[model samples]
Target chain A: MSFLELRGITRDWDGQGGVRDISLSLQRGDFLSILGPSGCGKSTLLRLIAGLEQPQHGTVVIDGRDVTALPPAQRNLSMVFQSYALFPHLNVAENVMFGLKVRRVAARERDRRLSDALKMTGLDGLERRKPAELSGGQRQRVALARAAVAEKPLCLMDEPLSNLDAKLRHSVRRDIRALARNLGLTVVYVTHDQGEAMSLSDTVALMNKGQVEQVGPPSTLYNQPATIFAAQFIGEPPMALVEGPLLGLREGLTVGLRPELIQLSPPEQAHLTARVLDCEFLGSETLVSLDHPAGQGLAVVLPGHASQVPGDSVGVILPEQDRRIFDTHSGRIEKASQQNPAALNRQNTAPRDGQTAPEATEPSFDLNRTTS
Target chain B: MAGPRAIQGPAMTDPLKLERRRRAIHGWLLLSPALAMLTVFALYPSVATFWTSLWSRGTRRNPSEFIGLENYRALLEDPTFWKVVWNNLLYAGVTIPASIAIALIMALWANSRIPARSFIRTAYFTPTVLPMIAAGNLWLFFYTPSFGILNKIGALFGAPSVNWLGQPDTALWAICIVTIWKEAGFFMVFYLAALQTIPPDLKEAAEIEGASRWTYLRRIVLPLLMPTTLFIFVNAMINSVKLIDHLFILTKGGPSDSSKLILYYIWENAFAYFDRPAAAAMTIFVLIVLGLLAAFQFLVLERRTHYQ
Candidate 1:
């Protein structure tokens, strides 16, 4: 059995989207991230597991015990809120020791755990300072220390580092990962930033419109998205989708191509001809926006910098193996044979060495000719 | 260059100095009306009262004479004065905490998501808008010996009807209950605002920390409400002395001066007995007590309470 399990959790608000029939199971020490845009019910899912909100139809089992009807205090889980939620009245040490004090732990044990937590979160000497006196990063560390001192088997963090600057968020993200690993705690972190989820979580549950679109390792979600939304939502520039004779396919059949998969090639040696519209120089690589006959604005990520200027004519090559075909009706992936039956049937009569047929070389129907 | 430097240093500051002076004069000009009113009505009367306390009351047969400390000595020796002081102490000691506790309970109830919350909140705050004299007269019907609601309920329980306002033992207690009922709802508004200001996340945090409801209230909610409590405490203290409107309606400090507060006694000495000197002496005493309380709150309690 999984250490923690949420079976068919569902909650709905009047106008706001809430989690709908979300079921997830996690083993001990698994770092799971619920990633989605704002108001996509990621926080609601965490609150359901934390027992802060009651699910209309589901059971939450922690350690093989049903805790659905229990209050948050009985759930034996700690949460680091997005606002840090540190008590303004209490100093750092007091805030860290709050959970222990609530549990009526012995003074000596509380002190030992408080000191250890403060030291672990790098807030040792700042124990005497109040939360208002601390910087945003320091307040975040105090919140972490409070949760760490609780020493619960599970921890929930709701965008805990979103309040910090980019530099501080990077450092705190590393610290959170390290702390979760060192403590052997199962963590369910919620964030909208995909990079944080991809880098920090062992498993990413990408949610869309109150439901889990796909849940897998970050690499799997990026590479083999289960749905069109997943494919479009995961990547930075997102996958470019083309339909209607693009990739030599019939209508109602679409093909998804990652920006990095398409290459700039000579017109005689390319699949389709296009003109460069814009080039965005992003430090390491340039994202070149091209105006293709298949779609008006298709993008390609080129390694290093692209010297292409606007309105420059170029040829675009989409390799056969890199093409992901989907059915436009259901927005689901389809086999190559199912997507383009004619192409598959023609391949049988063509050479077995995977060479392009001579008949396919001619631009039979000009893509740009029909458009402009 | 030297000549220009000598000329420019004062010249640079000249307009700025003139501007500051103009602003200060403008500020004082705007403030003169309020200052004049305060001097005439408050400061001058206070000094004149102190001056009046040194003279003995004069009748039509004799001229008023300076008695120096005799009025104060007489005040100290009066057993009624001592009783009034003790009664006021009991009134404050009982009303302050009882009203605060009730106000907090009202605030919590009003803030919760209980059914009929708006109606309940309106009912709780209804007493605050009523005039104190009206409330006093209303409670007077409830304290009547035989037919009052309280005694009628007592009779329903097979208990004998007791005179609530006519007896010395129960009179002060009755007044205290009235004061608590009158003040709790007024103070509830403050507590409600303070409670609303406390983030809901803190309650959730406490719950996840495994704190019981009582522990959450005592530790998190109460500590965070200390500043509000301190503010209400000062107001309640002042009201304890000044709130004698009820005594006039119910019992009128009767039954051998049982429910007589310090302010009521001062009013009686000044108006009923025509003893201005004794009244001035008592007013000065009240001022000293209030001043001490204010100092205690600012110096001791304010430091302990967290503002934000």
Candidate 2:
């Protein structure tokens, strides 16, 4: 048995919005990120595991114990809330030591843990300041320090960085990662930001509309997105999709092309011509946004500042071998042969996964390659 | 307009000096209205009352004269005045804490996700909306001798029909109960507002840290409510001496003035007894005590409560 397991979990309000039939497991030290857009039930799944929200039907097993009916405190886990939720009245030291005092831990042990957690979060000197007196980053650190001092094995975080500015967010993310690694904590972090999920976790469970779309390592999700939603959702300037029939493929299929893979060529020697709408100069690479006759918004990633003027016609070389074809009706990736739509690729075998929970053991095929 | 620094144009004058003069004039202009109103309504009456307290009562035959603290000296020596002071103290002590406690409990109940929550909140707040005189009259019906609702209910339990308002023993306590009932609902509004300002996330965070519901209330909710508590406390304190309307309808400070509070006694000294000097003396006493107590409360509690 795994250290934590959620088997057949289903919790839906009004038959919608909440998570549905999510089954996942993690080892003692695994860091799993439930990643999706807002309202995708990612936070719902994390809350269920934290025992904050009870699954209408499922068994939650934690460390060989069936804790499905247990209260949150009894589940022996700590959570960092998005609001930081620091007690306004208590200073930093008291806030961090709240849980320890609640459990009747001795004063000496409590002091040691409190000091260590504060030092770990860089909140050492601000111990006597109330939460209102601290900066937003410092308040966020106090919340982290509270979660850490508990010394719980499993930690759940719900968009904890959403409250901080970009600069502070990265530094806090580093602190969280360091704390988790040093403590060997099994963390189930819920976030809508793909970059945060990919950069932080060992495994990423991509969710859409209350179910897991695909679950695997960051590389697998980035490359071999198992569904159209995953392909469009998981990358910066995500995969550009177009009507398959416009590209001389089957009429009812949709074709996906990675922004970095689409090559710009001379108008006479290409698959299609698209008018450049604008160009964005993003320090390391430039994204040339184009309006294709068949595709609404497609962008091509070019390395190191390729500035193109708007309204210029450019040849878009969408390589046939790199195209990911999907059944438009189902939104799941199809296994079509790499070139000339020869046949369904043998790699994407299970069609049933499109409609239900996928067996995301990790993909066997390299689904995406960054070629820019 | 006769504005400040009208003698010179801006470019012709020292800019910093002109700006400072303009700001000072603007500041005084802004303050004039509120200051004028407070002077006429609050400050003038307080000073007049103090001035009256130092003089002797006037008769048509002999005009009033300054006796200098003679009325205050009489107040200290009178038995009824002492009794009224004790009654007022008991009234404030009972009603302030009792109403505040009941308000907090009611606010917590109404703030939670319960069946017909809005209905519960409205029901709790109903007493506050009714005029104090109307509430007094309403309670008058319940405190009436044999036919009152309370005695009627007590009869079912084989109890005798007690004269709740007519007797001296239960008279003050009966008034205390009515004040608590009237004021708790009003204070609950402040408490409910405070409770809503507290994010739901705090409770979840506390629960995740293994704090029980009671623990959360003690550590999180109560401390956060301290500001509202202090505000409500000051209001409830003033109300104890302030709300004497029900006394007018129900007891009228009868049964040898047993239920007579300080405010009622002051009114009696001025109108019924025709002793304006005595009433002014008592009014000054009440004002000094309330001022000192309010100042003490702010100094002591402002340090402890967290304000946003």
Candidate 3:
């Protein structure tokens, strides 16, 4: 059995959308992130697992025991809320020791655990100050210390770093990940930022409307998205999805390609020609927006500065193997061999100078092109 | 060069200085009416009261004479004055904490997801809207000895009939109960507002931290409502002295001055017995007590509670 399992959980309060029939299993020490937009039921799923909100229909089995009817206090899980939710009346030390005092832990042990937690979160010296006296980052650390001192096996965090500035967010994100790893605690983190989900979690569950669209390791979800929504929601600048023959594909099909896969080349060596509409010069890379005759718009990412301006006509080349084809009607992936007849015919009639023909007899056409 | 610049600086500032003086005069002119009203109504009466307390009452045959500290000495020596002081102190001691505690309970219940929440809230606050004398008359029927509802209920339980407001031992307590009922609802509105301001997430956090409901209330909810508690406490204390309207309708400070609060005693001395000097002395004493209480709350108690 998995260490923690949620079996067919469904909670709908207003006949509106809530988490519906969701099930997940986590191993010991695994970090899972439920990532989605606001009002997408990501936080509701976390609350159900924390036992703050009881699922109308489901069993939450933790460590081989069903705790479906248990209250939050009886579930033995610690949560770090989005608002920090530190007690304003209590100082730093008292806030950290609150859970232990509630459980009636020995004073000596409480002191030891509180000191360790404070030290780990780098809140050692400021134990006497109230939450109002601390900076935003310091208050966030105190919230983390409060949860950490509980020493529970499972920790749930609901966008704990969403209130911090960009620089402070980065540092606190690292601390949370480190704390989870070092303590060997199973953590279910919720975030709307895809970057935080992708970098910090071992497995990312991308939720849409009330269901999980995809659940896998971060790389698998990014490189081999199962649906059109997954592909568009995963990356920075998102994947460039073009319909009808942009990549020499058939009609009634959409081809998904990452921006970094398309390159600007000479017209003679390119498969499609397009005009650059805009270029955003990010510090590390330039994202160039291209307009094609067949599709709405396509984005191409190049490393460092690319000397391309608006209205500049450029040839676009897809590195044959880096394309993902999906059915337009169902939004499901169509295997390269069965779906792309034009590419197949091109492979048999004439092989390009530098490109090899795709293997015709390969049994299952892989959707992702693993570059490295 | 410095002499010419210095001489020209004042010359250039003349118009600005004149403008500032004109604005100041305009501001004071606008404020003169309000200042005059305050001096006539509040400041002047308070000073005249203090001055009157220093003189002895004048009879028709003799003119009023200054008797510095004699009224103060008479107040100290009077046994009835001491009894009334003790009664007011006891009234404050019993009503302040009891009203606050009951108000907090009412607030918690009204704020919870109980059925008929709005109805319960309105019922709890009904006494606050009713005039104190009206409420006092309403309770007077309930405490009317043989024919009263309380005695009727006591008869059903095989208990002997007892006088609720007639006896010295129960009169003050009976009045205390009435004061608590009347003021608890008024104070409940403040507690309810404070309780509503507490974030729901804090309660959820406490629950996830394994705190029981009682523990959460004691350790988190009550501590967070400290500022509201202090505010309500001051209001309740002032009401205990000021709100003697019920005494006129219910007990009349009767049965030998058992339940006479300070304000009622001051009214009797000034209007009933025609003793203005004694009434003025008592009024000054009440003012000193109120001032000290305000200072104690702001300076001492406020420092102990966290606000925000």
Candidate 4:
């Protein structure tokens, strides 16, 4: 049995804004991130799992026991809130030991765990300082220490690093990942930042419009997005969904090409000719936005700098191996095999590999014809 | 007119010293308004009251004479002064904590996700908006021995109509109820503001830790509310001592001074019996005690409080 199971969870406060029919399971010690844009119900889903918010319909089972009606405390979980939620008046030591003391853990045992958590979170020599006295990063560490000291099997974190600066966020992200692994804690982290979620989570549940678009390993989410939303949402500069007919493919299908895969070629020898819109200097590399009839928000990432000016025609090479076909009607990826008849027009995006499982919407794309 | 300090004015070219002098002048100019007002209204009255307490009360025939410690000695010997002190101590001891606790409870209830929340908050604050004398009259109808609300409720249980305000034992308590009723609603407003400042995330954090509602309130809510509590506490202490307005409408220190407080007794000494020196002495004693209490709250209790 799964260590944690949420079956058919539906909690829509206004029939518009909350999570709808979310069902997921986690193995022991899996770092799963619920990732989505702001107002996408990612935090709401985490609250439901923590038992802070009751779902209108769901059965929350943890460790094979039903905890659907249980209170947060009885469910035996710990949560790091988005605001840190450190007790403002309590000193750091007291704040970390609060859960232990509440559960009536022995003073000696509580002290042991408190010291371990503080040391682990790198909050030594700051035990007596209150939350108000600490800096933003330190306050976040105090919150982490508080959750860690509880020693519960499951921990829920709701954007715990959103308040910190970019530098602190990266360091704290590393600390959190290490701490979770060392303590053998099953964590459900919620965040809108794709970088944090993609880097930290063993599994990513990509959500949009209060529904999970796809749930898989991070690589699967990036390399083989199941829906058009997932394909558009993941990766830096995101996957460009080109209109299929522009790529000499059938109509009513969108072609998703990873930006890095497109190579600059001479206009006559290119797959499709496009005008350059602008170039953004990104230190090591530059992102070149393209005005193509095939796609919207099409941009190619180039090494060093691409000093392409606006209105200049740039040739882009679309690789056959990297192309993904998504239907325009349902916005679902059309793989090579097991073609669902629900698709209005059935076509195969030649699946490159079974592991990746995404391809072009057209059957035949002669590489020789496009290249010449 | 040139002095030793005047030698530097034309000779000095240092811009820093000139700027420092300008700031000093500005500081004094800013302070003068408050200083002048305090001297005329507060400082002068306190010093004059202390000085006058040492003199004898003058009659039409006999000129007033400086009689140090005579008024104080009379106050110390008077049994009514001792009784009034004891009554005032009990009044403050009972009213202060009770008013604060009730106010906090009311604030929490009003702050919750109850339906008609605004209506409840407005209702709770209604008593605070009423004048003390008006509230005192309203409670007078409730405490009226024969046909009052208390007797009317007691009648349902077949209990005899016992005089609440007319009796010595119950009169002080009845008057305490009036003060608490009038004061708690006002204090609740402060508590309500403090409660709203407490983030909802803290409660959720505590809940996730397996803490029951009561435990969360005790450990988290109470400590967070300490600053507001301290402010309200000092207010409650002062109100219990000085808020004798209700005494006039309610009991008026009835049944041989059972409900009399120190301020009421001081007013009686100065205005009713025309003994200014004695009243002045009593006022000095009350001020010393209040000042010491306020100092303790600020210096000691304040050290323990966490202000955000």
Superposed on all Cα atoms, the candidates' RMSDs to the truth, in angstroms, are 6.6, 6.8, 6.5, 6.7
Clashing pairs in 3: none
Candidate 2: Cα lDDT at B120:
91
List, residue by residue over A1-372, the lDDT tens digit for candidate 3. Answer: 588899999998887878989999999889999998888899999999888888889899887878899888877789999999999999999999998999999999999999999999999899999999999999999999998999999899999989999999999999999999888889999999999999999999998878887899999888888777778788887877765344456656677888888887777676666678899999799999987544334788989988797887777776667777777666677786755545532312112222333331222223232110
Give i-RMS (Å) per prediction.
0.8, 0.8, 0.7, 0.8
lDDT of each residue in B1-308, candidate 2, tens digit only: 34454534556378776777687678778889999999999999999999999999999997899999889889999999999989989988898899999999999999999999999999999998999888998998898878899989999998898999999999999999998898899999999999999998889888888889999999899999999999999888888888668888999987788999999999999999899999999999999999999998999988877898
Q: Give the TM-score of candidate 4.
A: 0.91
What class would a CAPRI assessor give candidate 3's docking? medium
What TM-score number comes out for model 1? 0.89
Superposed Cα deviation of residue B137, candidate 2 (Å): 2.8
State the lDDT of candidate 1 residue by residue for A295-324, as single tens digits: 523688988877897877677777677777
Error of 3 at B225 (Å): 1.4
Q: How large is the interface RMSD of candidate 1? A: 0.8
For the predicted complex of model 2, DockQ is 0.79
Those runs of model 3 whose alpha carbons end farther than 4 Å from true positions after fitting are A245-250, A293-297, A341-372, B1-40, B158-163
lDDT of 3 by residue, B150-204 (tens): 9999999988888989988899999999999988998999999999999999999
TM-score head-to-head 1 vs 3, winner: 3
Off by over 4 Å in 1: A13-16, A266-278, A290-297, A305-308, A311-314, A339-372, B1-13, B26-37, B58-67
Q: Can you give the TM-score per candidate against the true fold?
A: 0.89, 0.91, 0.90, 0.91
Computed on C-alpha atoms, the DockQ of candidate 3 is 0.72
